[model samples]
Target chain A: MNVLPRRQFIGQCCAAVGATGMMSALSALRATAAAASIPSGNNLPGTEADVASDYRALVCIFLNGGNDASNLIVPYDASGYAAYASARTALALPQSTLLPILPKTSDGRSFALHPSTGELKNLFEGGKLAILANVGTLVEPTTVAQYKAQSVKLPPQLFSHNDQQAQWQSSIPDQPFKTGWGGRMADLVNSLNTNSAVSMSMTLNGVNSFQVGNLISQLSVQPASASSPKGGPVAFARTTGGNNPNRYQTQKDLFTSPQSNLFSSAFGTLSSNAIGNSDALAAALAATGTIATSFPDTSLGNQLKSIAYLISAAGTLKLKRQVFFARIGGWDTHADQVEADVSLGAHAGLLQQVSQAMNAFYNATIELGCANQVTTFTASDFGRTFTSNGDGSDHGWGGHHLVLGGAVKGGDIYGRMPSPVVNGPDDTGLGRWIPTTSVDEYGATLARWFGVSDTNLPVAFPNIGRFAKPNLGFLG
Target chain B: MKPATIYLAVAAGFLLLLLVLRPDAGVATDPRSPRIAAPPAPPASAAPALAASPVASEERSPLADGLNAPAGTVDEDLRIVATLIEVFRSNFPRDGNPTGSNAEITAALTGRNRLRLALVPPDHPALNARGELCDRWGTPFFFHSESRVQTEIRSAGPDRKHWTEDDVVTKQ
Candidate 1:
């Protein structure tokens, strides 16, 4: 592998910080010291050559942009199917293109998927994937009339992307919050670990609002590669003083300087932490062994592959708990959503890639013997409207999401499926359905099953108390 | 007293003390840590009125407090525009993509108190795709995009002195 240059790495850091403007002279000195102190081989806590492994992790795949779910998981019953077809218009997937439906006895209901998701069908039938329908941000249990009359509060900027995305991740639609439900859940269970080499939260997609914690920050890693400050060892080693080592010494001196302000101190601390975490991650990666599972080579696939690689290395990291964040975009299909194959194109194509990769990842987890210990779930900003906006659907509230793993009560749909009519009882003026189940309820159930105590549930999900029941009964 | 009998009696007493102390020593604390003092709980009565004025507590959210300035002050307007800069840098296809580290960015912003640089015109190269002006915490201000120029304006007009919350605030 080609090594990243030291000067280039410093330049990138400079630019990143430069986005707001250049850092002070003192900050540069501290950063250099932190960079030099990065841990070397065998220095981390868990990688002592050999160790036994038994741990579990959850990987969350967030599909950004309000994913049009009406076309993703369709109603298969005769009446419901017809209503969906009528409302969706140009956006509807023909019955012929849908993945085969698995009829369930509980609600006398059956569902189909866009033909692109044939791989997903196999997993569902094999009892790996469970669907949750009509879920969105809610402060409390609300009705359409109540929503229209403003009797109860709703999430801020209901149809906007950034607002709703933060709301979904934080479970606090009332404002923009950094602590996601996942990060908060990590906060509760993070202290249980014996190893301090790795953090509870890791993100392949980069720094996100969802992975932030009050005290602990998420570690950002590259997909399928070692993570550092961009440029290689030499770049990191090159400092500002006369000799290579001089820069590091200068930086250390600056951080420890009594004259330094609180801001300077904080900058020194964070930069040092970043370098420390990166070095630890590199060491952990070096000590990992390969797994037999093969993931698809797509972007999402590469991300899952990294996640799998990390899980395979869990022994070396000495982690009892971990949360991985992965994301796939391009779901904002405004026009010509049909694929080149016609039946297997656009939105359908994206779903197929999602299903195939997930199924493969699930199988890999099983092969690794951590299948039951690992749970994978999906989340999105909001669901698209039931009615098609010419070629695609517009942004709407309350779309369906999926959860997959050996531990999930799979092979069925949870939550009330909204009527697929243009102006049904659940509709709020337009075709957007009011969510019967809050995002808080859905997240709380998962967090509960993941080992978060009932007492800590409110902290992970503040709005959970506003709902009648916290758990959605998805975990088996 | 017989020496062997005295020793056995002392050992028995020590064992009893150990057994009595062990249970209390091993007792579990509340399995969950007490909540970090969050801002006082939202009022039950106020819950119903959230729809009327939606953003009553937007400033208090962790994202707002940790990442950007609270959204009302001139500092906030500049910070909002900087968000667009962050987004543009993240979205740039060929310049080598990075997710933009929030911590590092935050440090960079705080290091140089450039929190009120929004008075500068949009034409400056510093406002370009990769080098956009950020708030004190390195949050790139959010703005609507129209080609290269981000459509967000910090001030209402040339004066920028009279801008209010009701003024047109661009969304990314």
Candidate 2:
């Protein structure tokens, strides 16, 4: 399928451009050819092999460092804020500075968000964002008494960063895991995609734990280079488009050469996939017109913009379902959480970027008429300790999360925030909370909506059976 | 898009291809393997003074030893807590009888020519305990009597959380 356009394109470029752009095109073609020759079969059993008209995608915005969710979603009620401030002391945000929000259920418990999340608040009010509260990794439904008694099973290395991050992505806190919940889900639904060569898992962040599965390794796209032709998002071996036909032909011959060496052949396959996906995706994005909505000129903003571009080209990519992963670090605010103004600081800046990028990306989806089909959620290494260490907070367990989409049941809070009282049942000393809702239940909810059947929910997330509700009802 | 840029990209890819396709490259060797080392275990004996521990001398500010200390946030904090401990130690003699309440010492840290309004991090260790005197990590310096006379001042140190290997202290 790829043999003709690749060779013909190189020939045309060489002829028309007088050797200019021919070499890059030739090498690119060779890479794509290898990429298209993927060793298939990570598909789920009983697949219909039917292309689906309805498209849905899940975008996971992973905050690399442990985010202080306590400060993210705050309480505005007098008694609640008093308790929260008393527990957190100097770490608590000023009550007046908070952006107050009206939740769907007016049960008298008033809530507010970090002031930087103004755009997110707008999204919530506009019925496009839902808050998932007090969610964390859990092996089973656990209680305070059971947690204290050492009676119930707990996630391995409870407070450690690496362990908890794996638990969140893998949904298997008890032991070592290979396949992430995203990759597993992609394997199941990928059969719906017409382009069998392109995997469903994609990440802007180089390699990540969440997008690796037995059947689905991420189609890891390089960040679009400013110098690249048409903001090239593909990671090519070298710059593309030049007058060096001899060098191009040599490189192309080497990449396209039939190999007998096992290791060489394997490397060829990987390079092939990378080059192929890059060629296909880059061309599609270049062909696509400019987006109307403006994305902030930040790293996260650019990544989200790239994701928006890809989602808009869904038909070109022949995608029925896709799982996207992106990361924005510097969330580990162990010190200097805020500034002298109290409203601005490291955490606030990150949150602001998140709000702006998410809002813009949401609008882009609408621009593509795929707004209802895409849902984006935020994840972190873990939540910070509820109580401040003085300047900032340390790592903690349970934290609130945000899920946004047109299809989501917004303006509501799912799960419950444990009492802010340090060592008050919810706290294990310095305010490290035991999670109320497990990651299993959370992933199952998203997976179910992504087209995984009720029976196949456990296949996507192994520990879903331990929790009561498979569907959290956020993605309505 | 330009002639020169495309050449550069192809050249970059060529260099990359050469690197990955190195003849001596080892098979199945991944440099990104996770290194999961266990944290050092907590000390078994809960000695109040913590004097027997090694850090008693290393963490002391030059001011505590009557020498001009280097200026740094951590050193300044250690000096602050050490100053408070010295002040509190003078109030309570070695006889194990309490001379002043925890509040008096906290108020003393607030007064002039002493520890100024040096705000600690929000959830400092002493946030739950009495005194508000905090260390560099914004964690409260752990100040309590072994009995009533000897005072122990501890900072959660770099980790910012108490009771870890990274903890620093005044007077061991």
Find the candidate with the highest DockQ and give its number. 2
- Model 2 lDDT tens row, A233-324: 44343314544557645665666577899777755554454455556656655555566778887878878887876676565556788888
Off by over 4 Å in 1: A1-54, A103-105, A176-178, A225-273, A339-341, B1-172
Q: How accurate locally, in lDDT, is each candidate?
A: 0.59, 0.64
User: What fraction of the true interface does each of the listed models get right, in terms of native contacts kept?
Assistant: 0.02, 0.00
TM-scores of the models, in the given order?
0.65, 0.68
Candidate 2: segments with Cα more than 4 A from true spot: A1-53, A228-233, A239-245, A260-262, A269-273, B1-172
Candidate 1: Cα lDDT at A51: 32
lDDT score, candidate 1, position A434: 88
In model 2, the Cα lDDT at residue B43 comes to: 33
Mark the 10 consecutive residues where model 1 chain A has the least summed lDDT.
A227-236
Model 1 lDDT per residue over A1-476, tens place: 12234444344333223212234212323323332333445433322222334466878999987788877788887787888878877676677767766735357766787777777777778787888889998877888777755566666456556667778888987654646887788878777655644565767775566765553345545665344212111123435433456666575456456545787777566445444444555555654555566777677877787777677656656667888888898776645666445455568767877988898889878776777778899888888768765556656789888898988888878898887787788887347878888899988888888788999999888877888768888787
